[model samples]
Structures are given as C-alpha cells and as structure tokens.
Target: MVSWYDPLVLAQTGVRSIISATIGSQADRRLLDALAAPKVEPSDFSVDAAGRPREELWLDYVADMGDGWDSTYTIAQTVSRPTLTLKDETGTTHETRGGEVLVFGGDEVYPTASVGEYEERTVKPWTAAMRGQRPAPHLFAIPGNHDWYDGLVSFMRLFCQGRHPAGWETHQRRSYFAVKLPHGWWLIGTDMQLESDLDEPQVHYFQEIAKRMREEDRIILCLAEPAWLVAQVRAPKERSYLNNNLDFLEEQVFGKKVSVFLTGDIHHYRRHANAEGRQKIIAGGGGAFLHPTHVPRKESELAEGFTQRKTFPAAEESRRLCWRTLGFVGHNPKFGVLTGLLYLLLSWMQVADLREGGTVTWNLGRVLGAALVNPGVILLSALLVLGLIGFADARFGRGRWVAGVLHGCAHLAGALLAFWAAFAISGAVLPLGSVPQQLLGAVLVFAVGFLLGPTLMGLYLLLSLNGFGAHPNEAFSALAIPDWKNFLRLRIDKDGRLWLYPIGIRRVPRAWKPGETAREPEWVADDKDATPPELIEPPIVIGLLHPH
Candidate 1:
C-alpha cells in the first residue's frame, strides 16, 4: 500500500503547498492557449461520417460502473446492457437504442485503481462487449475516488492514452477535460480531489478554460462525486467539497452559468432540481451494486436550487436512522462478528442493578426465565470452548478435558477483564441509553447466529429476513430491497434542447461464468418479449435541466 501521500494528507493548504508549487503550477501556457483558442481545427474526436458537426450530440453514459468480484453480480449491466429492440409503451415494437458518444461519469472500475484492475474489470469486459459494433462510440472518462486510489497512474494509462483498451480513440488529453461539441455546448469534466479539495492545477486549468470560452457558451459539467449524498447522509452542511467546487466554477470561472450538473458515485439514479431549473442528475448505476432508491423526496436535503424530481422504482418515506445504520452493518455478514464484538465490549460497565437484577434468593420464576435464554447463550459459548478444546487436544491427549476447561475459563476471564476496563472508562461519560444497550446485545446475538455458518444463517434469514442490499440477493436485516440500478442517455437536439432518458435494469448481465465466452448473452435487436426498458414517465424536458 505505498501511496503518494506522505502517507496521509497534511491539510487543506498545508503540506499541499509542495504539490501546488511543483505539478499544479507546471508551465503549460502554450498548450492551454492552444486548447482555449476559438475555432480550433477538429482532430480525431470527430462527429458523424460527413465530418460536418451536427447540432445535436448524443451522450450515453454510466457511472459507479465496475464489478467488485468479476462481472457476474455487479457488471452484468455493464456487459449485457444493449438497447433491446422492444415495444414502447404504445405497443409498437422498435429498436430502443443508446447515444453515439459514450461517456463515463467515474468509477469506471472498482476494488482498486490499479492498471491491472482496469484491464480485468473494465477493459476486458468492454472490449468483449464491443464485438457487435462497427465504429465504437467516442470514449471519455474522469477519475473517481477508486481511480485516484492508485495515484491516477492507472487512470492516465487507461483513459488519457491515445487509444482506449477497447481500441476506441480517447481524445481526452487530461484526466479532467473539456470536449468541444457542436451547438455552442461544452462538456467539462474535472478530476475531484478525492472528495477533499480541488487541486490548484484543476482550478487553474478551468480558469484558463473560462478565459477561452465565449461568455454566453453553456457547459454540461461532469463532477466526480455527488455532493448531495455526503451532504445529505454523512454530514449536514459539511463534506460539500464537490458542491463548493461547483460554486467556484459557476461563480468565479463560468460566471454563475452551468447548463447542467452531472455526477456519479451513489450507485443509484436521482434527478434533483428547483424552481430556478438547475438540476443535479445522479447516474451512478453503471455497474456497481445497487444503492437503495428509498430516500423520500421530502427528506432530501437539497440546496436552494435543487429538489428531487423523481427516483425510479418509487419508494416510501425512510425508517428510523438507527435501524438503517444496522441494515448497513448486516449487509456484509462477514464483518458482523467484529462489529458485534465492538458493541459487546462497550456493554460491560452498565449500572449495577442492570446486571444483578434478582434479590438475595432468586425466585424459581426468574431462574426458569434465565434458563430459557441461557441455552442459546450457552451454545454461543461452546464455540470459544471448542477452540480451546481443539488447541489442548492437539498438544495433549483427548482425555485432558480439565486442561481444555481451564484454558477456556482463563481466556474468558482475560476477555471479560479487558472489556470491563474499556467500558468503565467509556461509560463514565457515554450515558448509553437502554435502547442502544438492547440493540448492541441483539447485534451480538445475531453475530453469534451468523457464526454458525451459512446454513444456519440461511435458515434464520427465511424466518427473520427483511430484505437485501449491496447486491440483489445479499441479505440485509433492516433495509429492504435496493431498487435502483440505471444509466442515462442524454441528448442535445438540433433545437438546442436537452433530453434525459434514465432506464432501469432489474438484473445485471452474467459474466466470467463457466464457458465464459459461449455462455455469454447476445445483444438481441428484435426481442420484444424481453424486459422492456423501464422508461421513467413524464419525459424530462431540456428546460428542467438548464441553468437558472
């Protein structure tokens, strides 16, 4: 895990001063001037066959789009999602298709941002998917947090190269770029500072770009992170780094004019706007596991210029926040024991009466009540006991039951003492309430239940299952089905009007399975019987997306 950081960042502008003086302030005035020049000759990033730029440029895009574990569960949409030939809502069968220019918002590949990962996760899958195409769509991308995880070296090699891995020309010179489109439209994308601060180079680059563009020319801004997610869920008003960059771009650079704002990273589709018409459209469902679309419109904490227009697979008002946090915890059961142990460690130093509840002589009623619950707890204890038994039996003979019991008791005593000391210090000021105490105890119980392995967990899931999260079938105890996985097809027509098509997919395309090639699904151009594209209703208009 060698990283460029002096291991970690120094601060906002503290240690970053070195990077700012060196790389950020590199002498590139000649290149900047040339790029910013008006009426520049077209290079490889060309328009249609006629070489005459058309007024309308079609941008088909996806984001948060890479498989965590190969392609089966997460990357199916990435590999298999071709515009199926199907009957529209009117029942007339036709080829529903995608745009010509393919745009990737960010997080093109996942797990890590290494070059090898890009090759396996994005390049190979996309190249395979290119089998049915003639001239591939113009490919462009910006770096996400995952991409920056490896210091943008992989990002530059895969994306900033002259040609992409799939043999498509990537005309973007920098990780952050400005694409000159027809009809006075500009596609501006910037590399986010890994959700902290925009680097000085990026700001300087955009400033030069602003100096070059016409005052009236509009921009379709591509941002790396969706500030709304962090702004709403993680922090109230903090973690607005992305939005702060947006404001800087609009007010300081672009003079408070942005035609539209596009972002990814939430793994769901959301369209937000306000009365003034500025929109924030999140299309992170390129290939990652789905994020729940259950956040209520009213509960959304949008800025002055943004409000929720629609979220597909319409959902209900959210439940209590605590339950939601628990659901997130249960999504990956492998981590449940560690999380539960932490909770258990915090439980040792409760009020005296809470632990020793009975009088001097315990009633038979209380004893019976304790017995009923003790069996389950006793079974959980056996796991620890067996571990000690295994260790002692390996060293001593099977007859050494006394040694095993003593070892188990000794380990338990040490654990209890450590937990007691930790909890004593914390609970002095924590004031942990009754509900939190009960919730932690329940989590510990569930963790023990899961420790019985998948068979028992599966059986418990049937009786106590709530729904799934992270993936279509990954069980989460509190949160229900994660409903949204989608991509957007944005078009700017001859009339200079913007159009948005957010299409939802129920399942991902299967990938890297046995007989990997032959088992692959073909792109059907005339399958009207397949799952028809779930086109969200009330076709979105350009006015709804434009700058106020």
Candidate 2:
C-alpha cells in the first residue's frame, strides 16, 4: 500500500518544494539540463503534417494519467487511470483516430511529486504507447501539479531529451509549450506552477509568445486545471497562475482570439459553453478516480458564460449525484477498513476505564466527545443554518464563515446520521441480558463511521456550498456518479472545421494475445453503445467551423 507518509515521497516533496521556492522550477531545469537542453526550447513549435502543410490540424489530448499504471496504489489509494489507459490502447480507441499529434495534457503519474516515480509511472508506459504506433505520432506534454511536485525534474527528462523513447519523439524542453497548427489555429499549453499559480518568469514567458502572435490568430488553449471548476466565481480568471496567465494570453497575446479552451483535472468529462457558444471542455478522464457530474448546481448558473453542454448520465442536481461508481471498480477496501479499525481503536483508548478489580467499563459519550467537546460547535451549527441568508443576501456575496459553517454542519450531520444508523442496527444484534448493550452499540457505531470513512468525509467536503473548490465541486460532481473516464479528440478537417469528440471510456482495451495485431482490442464496444467514429462539431462563438 502506498502511504502518503512514505518516507521517500515526503522527503522528495519536502526537499523539492524548498528547491523550487528558492530558484523556481524552470531555472533548475535549465541548469540540470545544461548538457542535453536545447539553446531555445521554445514556448511553441510549428508543425506541418505529412510534410505538406495544411491550414487545418488534428490532435488528440489527455491528462491526469499518472495513477494506476501498475497497481502501485492498490492499498495506498485509488487506482483507475492506468487500467483505463490499457483499455483505451487495447480496445476503446479502435474506432477513433489517434491524432497525428498526441498531446499529453499533463499529470504523467500519480502521487508523482517525486522524480523517482516518473520513469516507472510515465516514461516507460507512454514511450511504449508512442513507439508501438506503426509510424509513431509526435508526443508532446505539459506538467500538471503532480509533475510539478518533483520540480519538473522527470518531466523535462522525458520530453526534453533529444533521443527518442521507444522511437517516439518528444521535442519540448520546458514545461510550457505551444504547437503552431496550420491556418490560424494555435495550440498553446501552459504549466500551472506550484499551488496553481504562475510566477513572474512564467508570465513573461507567455508574454513573449503573445507578442509574436497575430491579431487574428485563433487559439486552442490547454490548461492544467479547468477554469469553470467554481461555478459561483467563473470570471474566466480564478486566483491562480493558470487562470491569471490565461487572462494575460487573451488580453495581451492573441487579443481575445481564443476559440477552444481544453483542460483535464476533474477526472471526468464535461463540455461547458456560454450563451455566445464559446467552448470550455473538461476531459480529465484519461485515468483517475471518477468525479461525478452533478446536474443542477446550487449556483443559478455554473458561472459567467458557462453551462454544462453535455455529459453522460445527464441527471440533474447534486444530491442525486452521490455514490460515485460505488462498485464495479478495482479499488481495494483494505486500507479503508484499516482506517475504520483505527478510529474504533482510538475511540476505545480514549474512553475505556480499567478498575482495580481488572474490570473494564466503556464511556460511550466520552468516546465520541471529540466532537461534542468543541465549544464552537453550537455557534458553527447555527451559523451554518443562518448562513443560508447569504444565498439571499447579495451584499455578503461570499465569506470564509459561510464555507466553514456549511462544511461543519455537513460533517456533523453525516456523522450523526452514520452513528445513529449504526447504533440502531448494532443495538438490534445484541442480547437483552447484556451487562451494557450501549457499549456494543457504541463500538458498532464507531466501526460504521470509520468504515464509511471517505464516504463521511466526502459528504462533509461535498456540502461546501461556496462552490470555490468544494472537494468534489458539487457542480461537476454530486450525482449520477458514473466513471465518466474519457479523452478528447480534436480534428480540424481539410476545410478547417474543428471537431471535438469526448470519448467516454468503455473498458481498458483488453491486452492483445500472442500473434494479435494492434488493429483492434479483444473486446470492442457494441455498435449501439459505441461512440461514433467521427465526432460532431461543437458550436463556437467566434466563427464557423464545420466538416466538409
């Protein structure tokens, strides 16, 4: 099991954070890459497909792909993406074009905050994916938070090195990069520096790219995190490096010529659009724990110029969106069970009494009093109930108290509900002649609460109604919690119409047996359920882009 407290991981992250702070991530890249780094690892690269340049470009994009590659997270955390990738490679992708340019949006590995993990998680698998292609497509990548965890050490090595891995070329040297497509299409991808903010150097780097762009250049922007995550405060600018830089790129670089905004972080697929028809696509389903796509957001609208375009299992409302992929996943329940046991042990240790006669007595109230002992519980609970006024009071648009209240109440409610249910059920299982039936009831309650560990925590975090980074972002996640795992296929046809396909996962393509060609997966999607080979064009605000 991968413990977050693993000595090596903590040591690497702690050390890397200090180093990154002192010198910045990119400068360190330049220094460490002196021997192999190119003099000019550009912010963008211009590409012509098939040696005959066409204005239109075709590309495939995916992100959040570092988890589950080898079941390294079986007992440590959730593992889904790697298996999903295998499914895609082996079968799910049989019907789609793999794109001439396969861009790895970001996040090469999970818990990948260390350089030591990149090779095992990202380099080996992705290189094989690229190299195994009949005529390998060009591979480009950006650094996600996980990649940044190592200060971009492993990211630069895999993508910046001149040599081909498994024969697939990765030509960029820096974390942020762009690919100049034909016609007026430009694919600009940025790196969200640590804590989701871009530093001064990163700002200047994009500024240079912006200065070189034409007033009329249309951009296909890539961001590490989705801009529309917080439905309440969607200004196209969140208080983060990625969002701030996106603003600069629009205001300064291409002069607001952004045509398509693509991102992957939320571990599900969503196509958000505004009334004007500008598209913001979230296709984080490359391989990770599935995030739900809640239908009706508490926010009247998700955000300014943002609305859910389309999602699978299109149910409405957040409450209906809970219980995400409850089963049918390979997640190990051992760690969760262990956690439950730990909670029970702690509760027992805190309240168990030993008498001189070697008798033991249980104080149930004391056992659960970690919560009741808090002086602020009543104030916080009242604040949570009254804070609903903020929903009515436009004057106090948002405040920390509102968030804290909502979170506290939700947690309390979940705990109470869980404890009550467990006590009721466990109490029923006891004999009436028991010396103290409440003791057994209390132990069972503790067991149930801990066993439902994440479930309770997820409930608490989910109730943060502020919509400002709610743990599961009630908007995109809440109900109809399907494993909306997927990737995006963006193709600009010969006539320059851009087609965006959100390919939802069926199953990881089954592994090929001996003597099998990579032509198809062992099990293909049934025709009725199969995603159409060619995607329909999404409505765009700026100009007409249609298939010929």
RMSD in angstroms between candidate 1 and the native structure over all alpha carbons? 14.2
For model 2 the TM-score comes to 0.66
**How well is each residue in 109-149 modelled by candidate 2, as lDDT tens digits?**
76655555666665555543432234555777777766775
Q: How close is candidate 1 to the true structure, as a TM-score?
A: 0.62
Where does model 1 exceed 4 Å of error?
1-51, 68-96, 236-240, 296-301, 317-333, 336-449, 452-483, 509-532, 543-548
**Model 2, 317: alpha-carbon shift in Å?**
9.5
List RMSD in Å for every model shown.
14.2, 8.3
> Candidate 1 clashing pairs?
65-287, 76-509, 250-256, 273-307
- lDDT string for model 1 (1-548, tens) is 01111113213223334443343335422234335443332222225577887767666767876554322133233323455443334555443455667778888876556777788777765666555543467778887766766556677777765765676667766777777666666778877645345666567777876776776666778888777655544343445665686677878888745767888877667788777666678877666655555542234456675667776545542222213433343444544454246325323222222345342212334323443355443454466668546534221234446555664655443333333333333344444434454444445434543333233223222222223211112222223232346777776777767666666665333323332343343332232322334655434555423543
User: Which lDDT value does model 2 have at 242?
Assistant: 49
